[model samples]
Target: MKEWSVLLLSLTAAAFVLFAGAGTASAADGGKILIAYFSRADENYQVGYVEKGNTQVLAEAVAEATGGELFRIETERPYPKEYRETTEVAKREQNEGARPKLKSTPPDIGFYDVIFLGYPNWWGDMPMAVYTFLESYGSGAFAGKRIIPFCTAAGSGLSGTVGTIGKLCPGATVNNAFTMLGAEAQEFSDGTRAKVREWLVGTGLVK
Candidate 1:
């Protein structure tokens, strides 16, 4: 009887390992999509309104359903802890072509088939850390990779950001990006989640 119990536990463990391995393989194939985003705790603008930290909340929801890894792009030079002060710093960085160094790197980005890039729109474009990230990785590691970009901001839509990414990573495939007003992010609701599911299905990242 004791022997039988041990055998049952061993079998259960083995089954779990096999199941997990299969899941990873499917995700590695057409089902895998990675989420890489940068969000600041200080300040943001949304649909001609002002807000703070909406992009971070949105990314968490997206990653939950997809079961994808989330990497926050942090800068070596931290932005001001105060919102007003941070806004001033951001404006200055925008004035100069600034690429604040990132302190953290994505863990083994080579594992995913598709990449979902997210960020809050700043100065009608992506934050400089994004530029730093792209330039650091270059077009080699991501060559032929399918990229999906999603962002939140004030009234400014994706605008020149996509164009700029095109210029930066010349050889990658980019899909039509989505821009959500940061202030509206709290209302993502069930409908917004459904839209994300639709996107995953369209990208062949889900069954």
Candidate 2:
């Protein structure tokens, strides 16, 4: 009976070690998350008079859904407050391939394992400020991290921004991209959160 008891104890200890190892493995595989976005708050298309930028609203939704830290990418020189003026400036920047100086950057950028990059589609591409932010990180800065792109657009969806990001952040894993209409994001009360949640689930970022 004593020998049997010792045998049972040994088995129990082995099971506990196996279970603990499995839990540790799962934790190691689960990466830290960050939501970085460049958003505009003034005039926008489709949705009139919004206090928050369309991409900002969606980025907030993603942060809420995933419990990721939020980082706003700001430009050193603020863009024109008026929508039309902003569009012109954006167009000029894109045409010139100008990288506007970023006012702020992600905190401890290298610490985050998964980065959710959000921005508004400007003239069928991501805003120039976003490009500045990406370039600020330098080459191979996002080497081993996972990048998930999300965007808000009036009509043009994504506009090949995913490929652009892949090119910018060489060696980084760019996952599936999500694009939501500007109107949907602004009129969030009209099932915007639901759509964001659905996309998060689809991305396997949330249950």
Alpha carbon lDDT of each predicted model = 0.71, 0.83
Name the candidate that leads on lDDT: 2
Candidate 1 local lDDT, 1-207, one digit each (tens): 999999999999876543223233145465466788888765444323234366777777656656677778889888765666777777788889898888987556567676778888877778888888888874577777777788887778787887787677666788857777776774677666666556555655554
TM-score per prediction, in order, is 0.75, 0.84
Which number leads on TM-score?
Answer: 2
Model 1, clash count? 1
Q: TM-score for model 1? A: 0.75
How accurate locally is residue 141 in candidate 1, as Cα lDDT from 0 to 100? 71
Candidate 2 all-Cα RMSD: 10.6
Instruction: Give the per-residue lDDT of model 2 (tens digit) for 1-207.
Output: 999999999999876543223222112454788889999988888776678999999888777667688999998898877899999999999999998888875487788888899999998889988888888786888999889999999889999899999999999999878998988888887376667766777666666
